[model samples]
Target: MPKFCFVADLHMFARRSNAERYQDQIIKTARESELCILGGDIFDFRWSKYLTEDETAHAAVEWLREFDSQTNHCQVHFLLGNHDDHPELLERLPFLEQEMKTFEWSRYYYRLGDSLFLHGDVADKTMSAACLKLQREQFAHGSRTELHNRLYDVAIKAQLHRLAPPAVYPCKRVAKRILNYMDNIGHGRETGIKHVYFGHTHRPMDHYLYQGIHFHNGGAPIGDAPFRILQRTVSLNDGENGLESRIRE
Candidate 1:
């Protein structure tokens, strides 16, 4: 009955030239859909340290505020990702809280006519633990120097060069193993959820069935062309018996 747009892994810091254009596209997408779901990694990395209370951070905050205003009519749900450190980024702006909701390392078991919407990160317990540990360490460190940031950037670029074929993590075997293990538990036999949507792997895949469950990854919005699903639900009410169904694209 309600239509929503799902997007994730924007990696907003990766490219600056198209930042405004990307924001416009997101706003447009949100306007088109009744709701917009952000899968995570929306801010690129822990922004508080580098940005401080400076103009850069303020500008970024304003952009988000404007974007939220543009999508005031649409409900926005944000699932925490490895890259999003500041959950209170939008709280500084008025009326933004009503339009957007942010979750911290949690899973949203949304049931819309027997269809489930999951952010995918909740599927992997081990990786999630590791990522949390890393985040905690980063937070405790207080701030990173410019040199340290540059060095880390170099290391990431080097790693990317080595892991070109997969275009995601360097080791495909490890990646698959981690994903498989996560999928096994998150969608365990007892969950009873029929359809699930998630994004973190940045790979555009649909109709992948694991065990007895259906899995769909919406992919990243930064690469290729942004892709989202439009779902329609049909409900049948018959006195004591009710039937609900969904169709997605």
Candidate 2:
């Protein structure tokens, strides 16, 4: 038996993030868990308070190093989200992944047993998974000017990001595309993947099932929407099904 912890969209190092407030608790829970999934956007290089993108990248690595040291008993899996796909940080991730024994990084997703974990940025209505991944890869290798970064910060602070319509979950189209993606990656229905945990939409969902699969999201600690750290426990030897639940502060 092993316990799993999931937290996402903390947007750590962002100019106006509330992630710092939950730092201690996040570390405490990760330290206690057998596996910790840092769902995505754990670092917001776009809104970082650091003077330079390079400086922010350096700080992010140090934070990961400290996290690795503090959670020696836990396996930490970090999935990159849109905001965390900075070129500088992307370049450093491979090295960090090699340096830390318990730390792993993925540009796309991770599949464990009957569950799947992804950053959820591939849920667009028109784009195919391959297209979306290629677009993200292009963005990761792209550099942003200071002026462009400032504009992005201003737009976010103005809540312009919320102008888009919210997504309706249990969506058949999106679900089908996700399933197609899993099939391409060789983790389709045959793998017994019943649960999906993701972030990036910032909307939290718990065990929402559609087409025979369950979806769970640990909402971001941003804006006014409900948010909490998600926890689940399961026994590998017993072929058990785990329940997704939120941890209250």
Candidate 3:
């Protein structure tokens, strides 16, 4: 069985992020695991502390390089989130993919057997998969202005983003929407997908069942929710008790 470590929404480079503080712990765990999935928002281009977009892009690439160098012992898969999907950074991924042997990236989702892993923004309060894709497209193509970054900094300092707890616990609506989106993308139930692991709601969930699919979310370190690293021991039998949870201190 392959051991997997799943984490998301570290939001590195953002003024509000403490990911740098947790770097050692995260890297140590990733080095120990057979596979590590960085679910997304690992870089925060939208709320970056950098003065310009180009600077943020450069810093993000260098950050990736450093992280890749440290975790070369294990397979690290980075899935881009809305916050990190800037066009400038996206253009540089292929070169990094070639330079880093143990690291790879995906814009959408990664699947292994009956389990699917995604950044989960596709289901961010959307009613239809089409709307979800459209929303993602807009975010991907959008550029953040200095004014926008400043406003985000103020919002973060005010802790405005954390004011509202997620309306629903376990987020069944998101799980259902994710399933529908998967169906639209031809990676649905028919394709043997039985479990989903995602991030973006900043809500932690473990083994929550919706319409026969088990959903898991690690939650983000920044949000009101507790940060948990999801560990999965992959096996051929879906009924096996192979999922483990460790709360990151």
Candidate 4:
């Protein structure tokens, strides 16, 4: 059986990262797992504030490149978060191209067996995204899209509040909506996936079951951020209890 580890929201930057808090844990997990995956925000794009102009991004890219090079025992995969804004940031750093690094960037969710790993924001209607299955005929038409757009507009407006700082619109309601839209009481099950792993909530969630499916969150791994590990139990071949979370002490 292959071992798997999923980490999220390190928020690493050229100068700083919460990695030190759980660096030892990461090394241990990486050494044991067949595959190590970063759910999202491995870099601090928002605070880094270097997403534009030449050298669109900074230190995090080089740091990741070095980290991946050093860790060759298992596959290290990175899923970009809202802050990272995809691999396009690496275009400026020609030396750190994907071809040269051991780490690989995934544009979308990563699927392993019955589990799907995503940045979590994709399911967040409040963060300019939503599960499209909700827009189907079985439900209110255009309702999901409208709400997504409306929330996106709100996010855009919040962008202007940079000066104000800490103006995060609460998104607990959206998370609930996501769970309902994905797997509700009726046959409205969105996907056949048995397990879904997501980050970006900063709240590490354990094995929460909804409609017989498991939802696992990796949470933020920086500052007072309690590092949560998504581990695949070595003895079990079945998917149940696969996401064993190692919550921060």
Instruction: Name the best candidate (by lDDT).
Output: 3
Residue 115 in model 3: lDDT? 79
lDDT for model 4: 0.55
Off by over 4 Å in 3: 127-130, 140-163, 168-170, 223-225, 236-249
Q: Give all candidates' CA lDDT scores.
A: 0.49, 0.73, 0.75, 0.55
Model 3, span 1-249: residue lDDT tens? 788888899987775576766788888888888889889898887777777778888998898788777876588888888888777788888888899888788877777666788888866664454675567667733346678767766776676555533664337788888888787766777666778899888787899898888999877767333677888866545632233221110
Residue-level lDDT for 242 in candidate 1: 35
- Model 2, residue 190: what's the lDDT? 65
- Candidate 2, lDDT over the whole model: 0.73
Encode model 2's per-residue lDDT on 1-249: one tens digit a residue: 578899888888765567877888888889888999998789887667777889888998999999878776489888888888777888998889899889887777876666888777766544555676677767542335678767866776776544331445344555666677766666667657787888877776788777688878777766444568888864344242332221110
For model 1, the superposed segments whose C-alpha errors exceed 4 Å read: 14-21, 47-50, 53-61, 87-113, 122-192, 221-249
Q: What is the C-alpha RMSD of each candidate to the true structure, in Å?
A: 7.0, 5.7, 5.6, 10.3
> In model 4, where is the ten-residue run with the lowest total lDDT?
134-143
Candidates arranged by lDDT, highest first? 3, 2, 4, 1
TM-score of each: 0.59, 0.80, 0.83, 0.63
* Better structure of 3 and 4 per TM-score: 3
lDDT, candidate 2, residue 216?
Answer: 81
